[model samples]
Target: MKRLGLILLLLIGGFSVKASYKQDTTIVEFTDRGVKKRVTVYTSSKKDFELPRNLNLENVLRSMGVDSSERKKALVLIEQNGAKQDTILLLANDGRTVKIVAKDARDQLSRRDTLRNDSDHWSRSGRNNDDDEDDDDTTTYVKPKKKNSGGRFFSKSDFGFYLGLNNWANGASTVPSLQTWGSRFIALSFRRNATLINGKQMDLALSYGPEISWNNFMFEGNDYIDRSTEQVEFLVATKDLNKSKLVETSLNLPVMFNFGFEEAKLKIGIGGYVGYRVGSYRKLKYSDSRRKEINRDNFGLNDFRYGLTVEIGRRRGISFFGRYDMGDLFKSGQKNAAGLQAWTIGIRL
Candidate 1:
C-alpha cells in the first residue's frame, strides 16, 4: 500500500508512472480530511497506451498531489473507438472526481458534445464521502438485471386491454337481463405500479390508473330500456327483434394494492374504482334485413358509480379480474321492477 501511494503521489506530482503489463483498470483508495475516496483509472488501448505518460489529470481537474492538500485527485479512464473516445467521470458535490477521456484523433469531440455530455458526467452536486456507498452512488456504469415480470396486473407499468363478460349481480328487479354470451365487456387502460415492500417471501405493490370501459348488455328477452320515464324501465319491443342490447361507456379510475408471491410469479390484489358514465345508448336489430336502430340517452342510469375490483394471476402473463359496481343502476329514489347493479369478469393482458 505504501509503495502504491508513493507511486501515485509521484505520478500526480508531475513525476512518472510505470507498470509492468497493461490492465483495463487500476483502483486506488485514499482519504481527504474525514471522508474516504476512491479512484479508478482505465485506458483506451490497454496494450498500446501507457498511463501517466498520456494523462495529466492534475491539470485537467486542478487538483494537487500533496497529502497535506485537501484538493482530492481522481482516476482517468480512456476508451477509443474509431474517431470517438469515451471519458468516464464521477460527479459529486464533494471535491472527489473520476474522469474518463476517450481519444479520437481523426474526429475530435465537438465542443457542444463535450460541454453537454462530459461536463455533466464529470461534475455533480452531492456529498463525496470516503464510504464505498457514497462513491458508488456518484458513479456506476452497471446495468440492472431486466425482469420480464410486467404482466397485466403486476408490473411497474403496463397498457393493454381487458376482455370478458358483462352481467348484473344481486339484482332484485329485471333491468339488465343480459344474454349469457352476447353481453361483452372491454377496458382500455394504462396501469402504474409502485413497490411498497420487497423480500424473499413476497413483494407488495400499489397499482392505479385510468380506464375507459365499454359494457354491452344484451337482453335475453325481447326487451329494451325505455327512454321516456325518469325511472329505469324495460319495455318489450313491438317488432320481433333479432338483437336488443344497451351499451354503456364509462371513464373510471381504479387503485389496487397487491401482494406478489415469489414463486410462480403469482399475485393477488383487491381494490375499488369510481367511474362516471360518459355515454349510453340502446340498439335493436330486426329479424328482417333492416339496419340496426339507435337511441342515445342516459336511460335512467347513474352518471357516477363506484365498485370493487379483484385481480389475481401470473405477474407477467394472463390474469383474471372481477369488478362489481355498487348502488342501484339508476338515480336514487326512483323505483322500477328490476333493481340491478353491474358486474364484470374477464381476462386481462
Candidate 2:
C-alpha cells in the first residue's frame, strides 16, 4: 500500500507540471518627460498565437492620430528568459505602484510588428506606408490606384429614340399674332448622352432627326383682292380662298441639359433647336370668290425654322417627358405662316 501511494503521488506531481502554462509578455518604453515611463504589455495568449493575421498596428495608429513612422521607432523586443511571462502591461503613471494597464496579445503584437517594419521601410525610401492599420491624418497626398483613373469604355455611352406631336405656324396677316398653332405635326428623334458630372448632379444630352408637319392658314381683305377687279360674288369665293392644308418636312437638331433630383429619378432641362425644311406638300382647290375653278398654290414659305424646347421627367433608364418649341416656320412676307413647336412624352434608354 505504501509503494502504491508513492507511485500515485509521483503521477499526480507529473500531471501538475505538464498542465502549468506561462504566458509571454513585453515592455515598451517611451519618454513622456525627463522621467522614464515603462509600459509593460502581457503576451500570455501569445504562445498559442498563429500569425499572418487579418489585423495590423497601422490601423491603430491612424485611429489615434499618431505618426506611424515615428511610432515604429519606439518599438523594441525584450527577452524574458524563464521568468513568468508578464502578459500584463503596467504603465507607471507616477513613480511608484500606481500603474495603468495596457493589454495586448501575441496576435496583436505580431500585427504591430509588421506595421512598424512597413512604416520604417517607407520612411527610409520616402514612400507612403501601405499598412492597413497605420493611417496618418497628417498625410496631405494619397496616390490613387491606376484602375481609378478613367479608361475608354462603351459602357458610358447613351442612345435612345422618342416620338412626339408638333405644331407648325400659319402666318396669316389678319389672324391674331399670338395665335401661331396650326395643325398636328409628328416628329421622331435620336439622342446621345455626354459626360456625367457627379453621381447625381449634372448631365448633358444631344438629339437630332426628322419631322413631318401639316398646317393651314387664310386671309381675305378688300385690299388683298382688288375690289374693282373682283369679278365673282365675295361670299362663295372667300370660303375656298381661306382654307387649305400646308405640309412640311424638316431635319432638326437639339442640345439639352438634364438636371436631376431625387437620386437621379426626377429631372428637368431647357434647350433649343433649328430645323431645315426639306420639302412641302402642294395642293389645289377652287376659289369661291373668283366664281371660277382656280388653282391655289403657295410654295415659297416653308423653308427653315428655329425654336426653344423645355423638358421635364423621371429618369430611370426609361424617362417620361414633355417638350415645348417656339419659332417661326415661314418667311416674313409669307401669309398666315407659323414656326415649329411640339409637346412630347417619351422614354430614354
Q: What Cα-based lDDT does every candidate model obtain? A: 0.59, 0.35
Model 2 Cα lDDT, one tens digit per residue, 1-349: 8546534644553343222212222112211121122222111122221111112232222222334452342232112212222111111212111111222322234343454542211111122323211333422221211111142111233444454433324434443322234334455555554534433223343333343433332222211221122121112233444333344566777666656542224567567767776766533344554333323333544466666666666554545545444554444443333332334334433
TM-score of each: 0.56, 0.37
How high is the lDDT of residue 277 in model 2? 69
Cα deviation in Å at residue 81, candidate 1? 52
Candidate 1 clashes between residue pairs 3 or more apart in a chain or in different chains: 36-130, 87-100, 87-101, 88-100, 93-126, 173-338, 173-339, 174-338
Report how far off residue 118 is in candidate 2 (Å): 20
lDDT, residue 307, model 1? 90
Instruction: State the lDDT of candidate 1 residue by residue for 249-288, as single tens digits.
Output: 9999999898887544589989999999999999999887
Error of 2 at 128 (Å): 48
Poorly placed runs, candidate 1 (over 4 Å): 1-154, 173-176
Assess candidate 1 and give its lDDT: 0.59
